[model samples]
Target: MEGEEGTQNAHLILARKLFLLTHPDVQDIEKVRLREEVFDAVKSDDMAPLYETLAADKIIEMDQSILDSMRAKIGDEIRKLDEKIADAEENLGESEVREAHLAKSLFYIRIGDKDKALEQLKVTESKTVAVGQKMDLVFYTLQIGFFYMDFDLISKSIDKAKNLFEEGGDWERKNRLKVYEGLYCMSTRNFDKAASLFLDSISTFTTYDLFPYDTFVFYTVLTSIISLDRVSLKQKVVDAPEILTVIGKIPCLSEFLNSLYDCQYKSFFSAFAGLTEQIKFDRYLHPHFRYYMREVRTVVYSQFLESYKSVTIDAMAKAFGVTIEFIDLELSRFISAGKLHCKIDKVAGVLETNRPDAKNALYQSTIKQGDFLLNRIQKLSRVIDL
Candidate 1:
């Protein structure tokens, strides 16, 4: 009888502890009074401990009506308790206990523990054989590929995701699967493959069947593909002005493209810096690149002769609006093309200019005459059919 009474006292103490978590600690008496009202419900036997815990969480605090509605359900209270347990685990160190189990490897990723995340995903993949969870399993599989930067695994994961989607899986899951495929191709340095995937993903996301939530992912993936260096992939970087004109069609991607332009400007300035001693005009520009190099050349030459007398990469990036690395890429290209001539003098620091007229004069003479003839022919063609 004495033991039973002790157990009952312990239960009452546990109930009181749970109730205290919901009581607001603010100095405002009215706020405190309002919290007490909720706390009283928590202490009552009418609701379970899960209800009391949910009441303490910020998700519910933002909207009490959700909690009130959820409280009416029986087993859902257990689900709510599970959610609180998940939230509590988030506050622990990067190595979470729950992350090492089941179909929830994403929790480990959220904390940046990629190794542990992969381990959890492998475990989940082994245990789940059900058809309905294939998409979920595929999602975690792609996450594993990204976390470890495993290009081969990324390629295989795309195939797995496609198979899952084709099997009549969830619409939302399929949309995400398409995105993962495109991202995987990009990660593997398969830019051409990724470009097609991104375009297809965009089409799928725009279709009325897809949820609005998927739009952000679609735009981000498209931007990533377009932003890749055309030189790196041996493809032409499309004219920025032309690309910007079409950018508005994707509302989610407009701001991101503006940022890409800012990055391109920074890149152009970096290239200018390396060519200060010898302006190489043709090294980095791809065969199909359409931007006029004359404007960039003019700006760089003026800066080279400016009052600041600081023609270093850092200063050039500031003056021309681009990152230092971008300037470096352009410089290397010019050097390779033999368009820039470099020399050093103490007073001039590093001085650069286009190749001397004597050496390049013959080549320029042919190109200019040929270009002038071609322009005349094109003009005449526009005026007359033949």
Candidate 2:
């Protein structure tokens, strides 16, 4: 009898806390009175009335543990709420019905019925809701996107979020969407676009004092290194004040960036090798690892071509810390792609670089200039005739 009384007192305390926690602002006299009634119902252990009060109040942020307790004590009542959700439209207005669906979804999620939860979410998505409620729905949709690796849905969710927050005067949400969009681009191996987005996000985060500045800067520098030319990197990222501040804070990233900038292939590769597993396993970075590595190799090989007139394949392999066969294959790719004006001597095991013919280069430049002049003249002629 003592234990039973103790349990009842605990329940009463929890019920009161829940009511207090969720009660609307004091200025709202109607909500305050309703919440008092709900508190009374909770005190009387009349959970049916308590649930109705909570749903009418649109209180969906209750702790999962509390909901779990409610489920155990009055599960049939909650299940009945789910069944009645479809019919809610006949009795309640659309907004109230959507609130009921949202509440039902939360309940399903807490009870480990994700499919039902997703089903409820889908229904809620089709209905119109306020901006705040829409934001909540999009957030939950993004979570589902990540869980299932639904890239298409994730992309759509990102677009929806951007549209929702673009003019909503929410700088933080806008910048966050930019970061997620950048991550999606990075995952798709669209390094150029990703680099641009990351730079913009870094600027916003820095200006607004957003958290995760370190992560934003990391990806910005990394994507810039992979996609941007040295001149662009210097102008857009390396010399940017916000990015420089971030680099100053993250020492390893600083070292890596410097190594890449200075064309120190050995140091750059070593720095990358020492990167944390967090970077390696990052959802965005993991998929692009091979592509980024290849870009790094291209950067290294481009530098090598400019530095040496001829280098032995063995020496190149040793410098790059790779096998001769690997070096040969990479060189073959570069040569075939016309990115490197070089030829490999198989017998001599030498990579001979070819400088562009000055006469041919000058001739090509003259032709390009002449074509531009002709196009201008034709445009001027047309203007004169007109």
Candidate 3:
């Protein structure tokens, strides 16, 4: 019992020790060796001997004063990891160094220390240079943009990641970037824009059949729809199997559709009206979903709008393969944005066009843009280098 107790005390002592010092040489390589030494000693039952060599009877009975000193030392060691690019650069050889920097950077960010967190990220990027890991660099850069909510920088990073993804970027990372873009729009209360981005993301994977049954894509779609058209999303629940897959992963989301999408339909019709109004009032359209509307309008025309004549909240949701609540949230956003000029008649469970003129303009613009893109694609295809 005495030997076990002694070993346990030695383990604690070593665990609490500040093995990494902030000094240039010490931080660069000495600290790395010291950390390994401490880890190995404790695991191999060799720490007790080291404890005796460092200070006789120190582990057996440490007083308050000793404990206080240990706390201060530990605090000081941690400080070396805080916002220090030099320390990060020096510790490049260690695998755990970046993680340590991440923890320290998060601590600074949580406390509203923006500059400090950025400084740490710069250090992290520099260290990854010699390591030749572009993915780590991209992750750190993207992380900085995310925490700072810097969309311009985030977009730039996405552009850089396009090539990287071809080389080695995983699907999860690529999808995560889309989710981040969706989140950025959502933060601005541009629910239509957010929903469009989310839908485009879903279409990218789904159309290609690249990543079927991807829960993140499903969840993001559900989340974006909930933000813009919860009613339609609730209705879609009955039709789309993907919704069920997501609910299986996140059971709590099922609560959003409790009333069979009562809230979603009302919100959806209202948003649908808002969307048309927005097209006229707010000329800046949602970049992602703009194509979808154009495609549907070009393919169906007045007949397509006619198809939606009996489009109850549930029926519209079924057409889209999303939740009724998600549809409602989206429709609500369109109504708010003045993009969809449809009003919900709760008494009859139907949608009425709010402004026929705005709808005509929306239809015209979408058709023009689609034609423009198609022409651009064709012209590019005819390129012959002679």
lDDT of 1 by residue, 210-253 (tens): 12323334333343433444332123213333344454564334
What tens-digit string does per-residue lDDT give for candidate 2 at 302-322? 876788899899998887677
| TM-score versus the correct structure, for each prediction | 0.32, 0.59, 0.39
lDDT: which candidate is best? Answer: 2
Worst 10 residues of 3 by lDDT: 1-10
Q: Give each model's clash number.
A: 12, 0, 53
Q: What Cα-based lDDT does every candidate model obtain? A: 0.46, 0.67, 0.48
Using TM-score as the measure, the top candidate is 2
Clashing pairs in 2: none
C-alpha RMSD in Å of predicted model 3 compared with the true structure:
17.7
lDDT of 3: 0.48
